[model samples]
Target: MDYASLKQKLQAFERQLDATLAALPSRQWASSSALRIASELYEIGAFKNSGTDRAEYLDYGYAILASHFVAGEVGYQADISREADLRQLIADLSFASHYYMIREYLYYSYNVPESMSWSFGEGRVEIRFSDKSIPRQFFTVYNDQMLGSQSHFRNFNHSAEIIRLLENEPEGVVTPNFETADPLMRAEADLKLAAYFSLIAPDSQIDLGGYSYAQFLNVYRMLLTKALYHRYLARAQDAVGAIYMPEGQLLDGIAGELGISLDIGRRILKDLVFDLDAAANRVDATYFSLMREGEPGGRIVMRPHHFATAEGLVNMLRVIAQRRPQTFLDRVSNEIGRAFVQRVKAAWEAEGFTCLSEVSLRDFDPKLPDIDLLVISCEPTLGYIIHVCELKCPVPPRWAKDQLKVLNKDSVSKAFRQVEVLQRFLRTEAGVQFLARVLPKEGHPHFRDFVVALNHLIITSDNAGMFFGAETTRAINFRTLERLLSRSDGDMALIQHILSTYDEHADEALVTTMVEFQLGSLTVAYEGVTASPLLEFPQGSWRSSPDRQAMVDAFIADGAHPFDVLELHPPDVVVNDHSIRVTADEEVPKK
Candidate 1:
């Protein structure tokens, strides 16, 4: 179906969902039913049933719920206590979710012909794709690579390491710093201080649904800890039943832990509980409510999935941070940038490089932006290579919809522009003079006449994906930079070589598709083009490059099944002065 037709279909299904939900008895019942269904899905491994995994299913469900129930506030209530009602509700929701999933998939995949052929049957949707399609092939390989990378980098330990680095910075650098090895301990201390700060400046304090940020964090931690304990119990003893703790007991425990009074703890508990009334029809409704007030005994009911894994806890915390007031986040972000720059400066100094942090170019020109970092390295061949490093420690995008925002020009435009300004300045006679003044020339007498090379770099805290081509600036993660530094061992030439040739290496590593077809006697070529290493392509037309079509055709037809997935082999990168070409595409083996 066309875009309009498919959108209409989606809207129709959405209306059906709304009608189904409207027939429910009460909003409370709907919430309970959703929770129950989620639990059942978890227990029966419904997430992993069929080819789709639990994570993907949950992601889709979360998106759908956030859009429909949360945003629209469609109160669909049902008496889940009735067996038949529960069963029918589950079946209805399941079918609606599956249908929505297919429609959403088809809607996004309209650009590719292969994705157009799909069928829904037996409460399941199946999509067929021609293996020859470049978009299909690119997405398959790119998704595998991205998933693997994301899994490795999104670990809690990785975040903890960054937190540790921030905490270790000088007292005035990262405010309310806690010098603790354990992330949880550090988090608690930081929250307490932040809460105190909030109280001191009530006018500027971030609103956490009436409770102080510290109180919110405290209650969340308590709930998460309890949920984790219950999860452990379930796993160890096969106890599938839900555990309810008395409100008084939970408050008492938190009060003791935080050295607060029972009254204060009780207030915090009230703040923490899922206020269905207050949050109704809000997008932030479901996620912020980790605990609900259980009926019959002033007990607390924790969401089963919120704290199921350490990763989940981290994700929830991340969401909370992201959802906070932008002003507060901006302040925190500035501090984080300072902390990261300090870390980078320290690392560079340790490596015996002359590194300048936050070098103000306004002294030279009022309009020029300040450089985050400037490194000067003296090489035997190039004499001196100046590295213009623009440091960015942006919070990685959380949702699937936000993923594309990472590569948006707006995100990195300032950094790129800053670097470009410096590069432009450096090429002038005044720039040479500025460089001569900035460069440490105590050892070398002939520094003035020595050849100089400038390498522009944008280094981030996390992998923001590969940005290649002439227009894009070279961006690398902190880990990669650390590796390069360690391997180079203060060799300027090696660093320059690697930094200069990074784009070429990345391009070789990620294979672009080139298809050839014989239309009668004429040969037509189709070249797959991607604007970024995120594997995003133009919607309407693929680029054409006839030169590589033969190679692609040969590679595909040489006893290798077109559908056989090709794994990305990272270049055997070595840090040295000598120029070397590295490619990551290995020939696929015959099936």
Candidate 2:
């Protein structure tokens, strides 16, 4: 379909989805049912798989929950009683969410093919490509690459280790002011909590749902204790179940533990109970909301699914602790930047490179921006090589919706601009003077006599795939940088080659052309391309394809093998189809 027609079709679909969701029952019931469904799906090993299967299961569950939270704000009678009814609801919501996600990407992406090749009619959309390989390329870019770049839970183990160290700190120490505190000090949960607490004025009573900050913290700790207890009991008994406690006894227990009165404890529990009335129209549901009044009796119920483990409790606490003043947020960001620089410095210094952190030529040239890191290495053939490093700690973008915004802000686009500015300034006469002042005294005299090469690198805490084949500035993940640093001692040649090359190999060792993508009725067929080291291929290796051969030859002429270009950089797959046909009730064509 034409671009305008395509937009109209997608908009109609979105409106229909909204109408369907608006007609659904109360979100509270939907949410509760979604949780139960998720639990069931997990029990059936739906989450144990990986790749497309895993994505499908997660999307299915998330769609049901998200639709209710998004559109079913008004309460109504829930008629979805049978298994088949619930399954159909899930299927409908899943399709809506899944279709919207793909539609948004296709509608808003800057990388969309210039030529139109897609058609839509009778509740189906089909996209065709002139080159068979384009489908695979699309999948590799959207699915495999994007999936591999997700690092949300990757740092849990690291954060857990940090928590372990923080717990060992002596208690009762005065909490330092996070704003003016030393950036080098390891971040402690207690200090972070205190920072958040200080945001509230002493005279003003801040109500988080109902409890005061202190009471909320106490309740949080109590829940964490219960979670830990359940874990321990489960291991000992070789079984898992809810922990039911007499409501009065639970209140009294917490009261004694926190040195509070029973009346106050009761008030806390009353406020903390997951009241569906209070949570209506709110999507910010927490583990605290899982605590419920049990069976009209004087008992409280803590289900196994409610705050499953201590780790989960810690994760929730971390999220809560982050809701601090902007000043505290800035300080935390600075601390993370400092830590990343220290890590990079240590890694490079261990490999015999002169590394500097927070290097700036602003004193000598006010216009020059500060560099996050600087590394200098001497090679027998290349003399002295300097790396101008810019560090960014951006949260990796989500799989859909405003991901491009994240990529543009304080990430790939911003990093590239900063690095380019620094490089431009460094190439000037003033830049040479500043560099001369910073260079080691021993090497200053010989620096001008020998060749000195400058290389720019943008290092991020998380992988950003948008600038994968960028030529002007190299973007690399910190993990990839660490790996390269570790190998530099024995393989400086490979390191140098990577630093100078503008290709996917700069970030990852393996390069593949295999790709696939599937979204609702749309499917991109996969084509497997054998992965091989580009360094092993010679010039004209891909002569069968003139374009590929030209690319290989260009890289070979630039003092590298054809493999370095064709294998690492690979030609962009072009979709040049001009014909479009719409079908009704017809099966989707397969490759």
The lDDT per prediction is 0.47, 0.46
**CA lDDT of 11 in candidate 2?**
70
Any runs in candidate 1 off by more than 4 Å, and if so which? 1-29, 43-56, 66-224, 240-249, 261-281, 284-331, 344-353, 378-381, 400-410, 444-449, 461-470, 477-591
The superposed Cα distance between candidate 1 and the true structure at residue 343, in angstroms, equals 3.9
Per-candidate TM vs. native?
0.55, 0.55
In the range 454-564, model 1's lDDT, one tens digit per residue, is: 677887655333222234567665655655665565656566667666544545545444333322232323334332355221121111225434654565456443222
Query: Which residue pairs overlap in candidate 2's backbone?
Result: 1-118, 139-516, 534-563
In model 1, pairs of residues that clash are 21-76, 24-77, 25-77
